[model samples]
Target: GENVGLHLPTLSVQEGDNSIINCAYSNSASDYFIWYKQESGKGPQFIIDIRSNMDKRQGQRVTVLLNKTVKHLSLQIAATQPGDSAVYFCAEKDNTDKLIFGTGTRLQVFP
Candidate 1:
């Protein structure tokens, strides 16, 4: 059987510094990618997204980069803050519109 998904479990960063979270996906057929941030007791919030046609996309203080050749995705956060502390997830959407989420990465920001 082939593997279908992947993720990094945790990341720690210093407040006021930049943070980079990485993810690897197994479905090469997936076309859309989304990054989500989940706070305690809250639902996942949309942070950013990129399409397979694009190699990179940027939002406010966040950036998402996709490498189809390696089936890798990365999220970069500038000037990480306390509010940035949370669990982050990467999701892939196939042509069927089904989204498969990676395990998750808990981002801990220390002051």
Candidate 2:
């Protein structure tokens, strides 16, 4: 089975600052990668994604970067807000279309 894991368990950031979360995947064959934000007692929500072919992709205030060579992935959030506080996870989709989720990083945004 494929495995995805986070480099850090928690990250704390001040409001209006930037936040970065890191992840690592075991499946090098994975073609697609996705970053998700999960609020307390809620399901994960899609934030951004980057395919293996691309190095980076950006959304409204979020960015996803993939490094196939090192099997590393990262998510960058701009202007962190209280609402942005959540558990962030990175998921990888393999050739079989199976999605493997990481342990998740808890993002704590403080005023």
Candidate 3:
């Protein structure tokens, strides 16, 4: 997966059993959604994706919920561990060359 950034800061999360990352999108016309995970200093890895027509999408222990009516979304991780710790992000695209992404969520692994 490829991530496009525009000089934004980062959001941090502590290591734990589970974590919930929230995202709010501006484009109500957007119909595509994807959640990506990026480990320390690495490229964003595809976690899961959902089309606008779907309200929820899930992947190995991860779930992405889309609220099309309000244009809000969230990603939930289960049994979060050290190795599972990473920055998570949500993206949306609507017939555009690039997908818009939130700042980022960095999950810290505490030993």
Q: Ten-residue segment with the worst summed lDDT in candidate 1?
A: 1-10
Number of the top lDDT candidate? 1
Per-residue accuracy of model 2 over 1-111 as CA lDDT, tens digit each: 112223547899999999999998999899999998887666788888888999999899998989999999999999999999888889999989978998898898999
- lDDT at 107, model 2: 92
How far in Å is the alpha carbon of 59 misplaced in model 1? 0.5
Per-residue CA lDDT of candidate 1, range 1-111, in tens?
112112447788999999999999999999999999988777889999999999999999999999999999999999999999888889999989988998888898999
Give the clashing pairs for model 3. none
| TM-score per model over all chains | 0.91, 0.91, 0.80
Worst 10 residues of 3 by lDDT: 1-10
Model 1 regions more than 4 Å off = 1-8
Which residue segments of model 3 deviate by more than 4 Å?
1-16
Count backbone overlaps in model 1: 0
Model 2 global lDDT (CA atoms, 0 to 1): 0.88
Which of the two candidates, 2 or 3, achieves a greater lDDT against the reference? 2
1 or 3, which is superior by TM-score?
Answer: 1
lDDT-sorted candidate list, best first: 1, 2, 3
